[model samples]
Target: MDYLAATAEKKYLMYISQNYSYAILRPLQQEILAHGGEVKWFLEGDEVNPDFLHQEEQRLMSLNDVKEWQPDIVYLPGNIVPNFIPGKKVKVFHGFNSGKRVNNGLDNHFKIRDCFDLYCTQGPSTTTTFTELAQKHGYFQVKETGWPTLDPYFSEVENNPYEDKQDPRKTLLICSTFSRRISLAPKLYEQIKAFSEQGKWRILMQFHPKMPSELVAQYKALQNENLTFVETDNVLPLLKAADVMLCDTSSILLMFILQRKPVVTFCNQNPDEHLVDITDADKIEQAIDYALTEPDELMAKIEHFCQQLHPYQDGLSSQRVLAASNELLLSNPALKPKPRNFIRNLKMRKKLNYWRW
Candidate 1:
């Protein structure tokens, strides 16, 4: 019986985000290293300006070094898949999100689908979408393992007591991803004003990864005594501190759902513009109003949804993710070979043509 520990002596490369995806990748890397494999990390930094080209070239050189070492496998965490590499000699596995309806109707999604050797999704719906894409692309091997991050929440462990303190006054967590495409600032500001006017609950605003520091400062300047803002690398601890989470179409809501905490998703932006299905917009709004007006009812609904959607909310997700990876590695021992190096092959052809001339 050749176990993962014995086989993982081979080298592996992991492509990950320097800030956002570290929480997910760090644990997986640790597991691989525990099994005797050597792991190298290739970090993708925020490319917010013209200097992005230089940063990308430097990163490419790092990747080239990894290629030269010829690792047996490459694992890419969500939204950071490396599709530009020419060789398929190393098996590439992509981890993806499934909470939102419309993800990757853009260029990044297409690149991920076309380039990765294997796809792994967090939600059932996402698995279906990936399966369809795989069939369309004539690549038929994709796996659906529920969101690895949520595995901890679903595990068998004592619920954090601090998470369930039901005071007559509740805390509302305003969560949103900072994207120009859908600036949640306007809607969140409006909700804060309205929610505060009621004076029934405290509000905590947590900014997204891409949010500007000035925006957070400006938000703090308003200084509604009941309002607080959290800016940190870890939002899960904050999520546990919250009673309710309000936001628009980001995967954080799914995390809240795992907690069995009340959630209200805002659909202030044009729904059709994004690929997300917004047919339940009115219901989402109603849920928000219900949470504000009748906390007990909203909490009950959240509990029901959690019972149906997630029966597990412990902190063992990292372990489950490792188990899933081990299962995958056991099922497939042969590494996928990369096609001929595109650039080298092209240069060789050019040299041969010159000699003929």
Candidate 2:
């Protein structure tokens, strides 16, 4: 029996449907290219602009293209994938679960949609949970490969990306989750603008791609000498450059905190010791000021938090993810039968406009 060894002839599909997927899966693309493996992208939804595809990158234009070009495995950074896609589905995950829950209080992050054959988890925080889920589900395997999006974050950026920002003062990255109910972007706009005008810190603000355009515009208009607004598909650059972060509730905050830096969040729904959480918009300034000081207790807690999250900083997570994928193929693990969710599959087919068997 062939073990389906990973070779130069191996073909992989990068299944992405969000703006951030470009950054999350691109490092793995580079690794695939380096190993002489074939990689192609399929941007699933309108939320992902086709123009964002680099000139050198190839994208499958239609469902027919995806169906005909049988790939050995599919790597997905987002939550869902069409069941019709012909490949072993793997979920690399989009972000850490920083306490955002569904209506039933279930973790959206850990929700088993029964779509993936493997999960390349980020660290111990997720690994143990995903492992238990894997045992329960019996149809998917879990591997702690870290996150590929952050590979470049560790190895590529120079020691001083801040100097390039031209700001000696502490840098602040302001971001928020897209939920209207919890987002502090709109409420804290004046405070952020005033802080920027004060010139005590350089402000770098970015929002989720799904963030309402009008609200995003409000912050965009406030850009001045001390503050800059960016909307790149990748946030690692901003993450690397930021000295601290101000936000309400978003996985991006967890991303920044991975550096063991302090984060000031406004009315975080799941406020923990890991964050400098404040209840009022007016309190953001004082909260940020306290964060900038890097209180020893907060710093120490952040250090512990970092270990549970992504502990890898060697910039080789992409390599690990690929290797784990190959291991999965080698094992061809026997799995229990999955439920026939015809309704879900139908929705997926309609979304992609592909119904033909």
The local distance difference test score of each candidate is 0.52, 0.85
Question: At residue 253, what lDDT does model 1 achieve?
Answer: 65
| Minimal lDDT window, size 10, model 2 | 1-10
For model 2 the TM-score comes to 0.95
Task: Write one digit per residue (lDDT tens) for candidate 2, span 151-205.
Answer: 9877657654444545468888999889888888768877887998898988888
Estimate candidate 2's RMSD in Å. Answer: 2.1
Candidate 1 lDDT, tens digit per residue, 1-357? Answer: 444554366655656553545455555555666677776655544422223222212232354565576655566654334434322222222323323434455423334333355665554535566677766665425655444444434444355423435555577777776664555565456546656666666667777766776767767765575666766544566677776777765656656656655566566332221122223533543555465564565557656654444344554444444444555455663434433355654554453332221
Which residue ranges in model 2 land beyond 4 Å of their true spot? 1-5, 158-165
Model 2 misses residue 354 by how many Å? 0.5
Cα displacement (Å) at residue 56, model 1: 26
| Most accurate candidate by TM-score | 2
